[model samples]
Target: MSDVAEPAPSLARLGYSERWKALFAPMADDDFVPGRVMRIDRGIATVGTGAAVVAAEPAAHLVKTTGIGSRFAVGDWVALAMPETHERAIIEAILPRTSAFVRRQPGERETGQVVAANTDTIFIVQALAPRGPNLRRLERELVIAWDGGATPVVVLTKADLVSAADADAMREAVGAIAHGVDIQVVSGHTGQNISALRSYAEDDATIALFGASGVGKSTLVNRLVGADVQATREIRDSDGRGRHATVVREMIFLPDSGVIIDTPGMRALALWDADDGVSAAFPDIEEFAHACQFRDCTHTAEPGCAVLAAAETGELTDERLDSYQRLRKELEVSSARQNDKLRAEKKREDKIFSKAARRYWQSHPGQGGRD
Candidate 1:
């Protein structure tokens, strides 16, 4: 059974535009049709090629390619082979993405996992339930969202569980760290402010909901689409934490509007290639650094560090500065690891080429290089 329960939407409805047309025009293969990847199940992907949604597998190039890490994510527009058998569609290529929400693959050193692709906006869904959303985790989510090149909106869910005053207080706390991001509080129980979320998806934009488990992202998806597209599980307290987690990253086509991508609740969103993300997430810190005497001041115990001065005077919270410093250090460590990996790869490649060259020269007598 296909995970895409709704009828396959047209390519335009799937957020195809002139950009897609330009990309598809150069493809010499006339048998290929553009399609948006709806979901990936097992080794097969459910792709919506305007005509219909069909299960397809990636062609050898997409699978064997070295650099393209986790090539397909929901919201990616791909070139699908038009074969005689409708079920035999092959994903020949993945079009360049406008933005991708990526994080370090869990337990992997430097590999990145794409959570969503070609996303326009990301809702950093945080729960305002019995225990308020983890402020630290919310900040980290915002960093990844901004790093992905999509607009981040801090969405506080489960507002019904809290008093109106408490909800407002949580929103303000989020606003303090979220900087330029917009914040919205929606309660599924009261059906309050749910309609407003739809506006973010207007103009054929693709919005993805991202947060930790039990944030009500599944329930929010069903509500925003005005249907039971995503099955919601009861909030389980078996482990002292309520969770209604989605199984996989799935795309939901909103009726007469845009697309909404609901992703599996992530337990840990590790940082991956997120230098600009930290800068974007901590704009207030960046602003303060401009007035520092030394350009490379670490903002810790530096005599002329404006950031430290702000914290001392309560212009900036000590916690906020600490978060910025920690993320910056984390990004630096990730960068060093990636550099080492790349250098090792280059060294291995050179060794292989040298062996190949030696064999070629030995076979060709005086020939030392390819002509």
Candidate 2:
């Protein structure tokens, strides 16, 4: 590592702390500058330093890194190297993340994509307009949020379109799935609970807004920031479905409050290594799982299954128990797939190394025997 000083004061203004400073100390390089990634598009990233926001590009080494999780993501603190040949600074290294929101990469691959890094809270926004919030999706979102090492807070948006009674009912439904997490109800149109929502965006805290389109994530961000930083569009009147407004993931800093990372509406959020997250998200199921007859009981068809017994005796609802089993099975399958991928990768590497050794032996036949 090249010798460099601690992060500048400008970084402190953007949520830099002593923890990050200590992590950066060993990786510091004199030739590189430090900055936080605010936006990334088409292999280019917009990084915000205390002085100015600059566009940066990942270096060749960073590009060769395999999984999207290994690459630069919004909220990542990076070390930038200014090369004379290119106009954009090269992101040479990414600082260790305290927490990262990740989901399984789209398609058949077992890899994952890191959505955001170093996040303190994940605002799981769900609209309460056309229909009540999807508790199943909320449960899944909570799993990923907990898996990412960030606190999960459910935010029910579009309450203005629905009556207060309907909003309260929806909140109760969500509370069933949310467990101990805080649930906030807010309306961008009526400005209801906007102050309470703003309270989470305290100074130096990083919060990421995640939800489907038309969930009022952008509107909420605009309200909290006291400016229309993110563009908002009207949803389709017929279905109340919203268009993909925030197409990119971007970090917006609030002058008075903290920072907010806005992400586009996700079509799907598949699980990836969310075992602990599932247990944390479904504490009731985990609590019963401890009393299972067998340590590896599946709970579906097992003797002395406390989880199944709870469901049969009216202690737990069938829907909730089904959701728990479904998510648990998904996690098990994902773990198996990931293990297979790792073994395949190891075999490929061994084959490559073996071939290289054979070629070296042929080139230096006399010396190969001695060494």
Which pairs clash in the backbone of model 1? Answer: none
Using all chains and alpha carbons, the TM-scores for the candidates as numbered come to: 0.90, 0.90
Backbone clashes in model 2, listed as residue pairs: none
lDDT of each: 0.85, 0.84
Residue 144 error for model 1, in Å? 0.6
After aligning candidate 1 to the native by TM-score, how far in Å is the CA of 61 from where it should be?
A: 1.2
User: How many steric overlaps does candidate 1 have?
Assistant: 0
What are the C-alpha RMSDs, in order, of all predicted structures? 3.2, 4.4
True lDDT of residue 311, candidate 1: 92
Point to the candidate with the largest lDDT: 1
Q: What is candidate 1's lDDT per residue for 1-371, written digit by digit as tens?
A: 23244466888888889998899877736778898988877767788878788888888887887554438888888888866745468888888888999899899877888888999999999989868878989888989999989999988999988999999999998888999998999986567899888899888999999987777888888888777878776756744255445777788888778999988789878899988899899999999999999998988787898999999999999899989988888888988999999999999999999999888887898554654
Index of the highest-TM-score prediction: 1
Q: How displaced is residue 202 in candidate 1, in Å?
A: 1.1
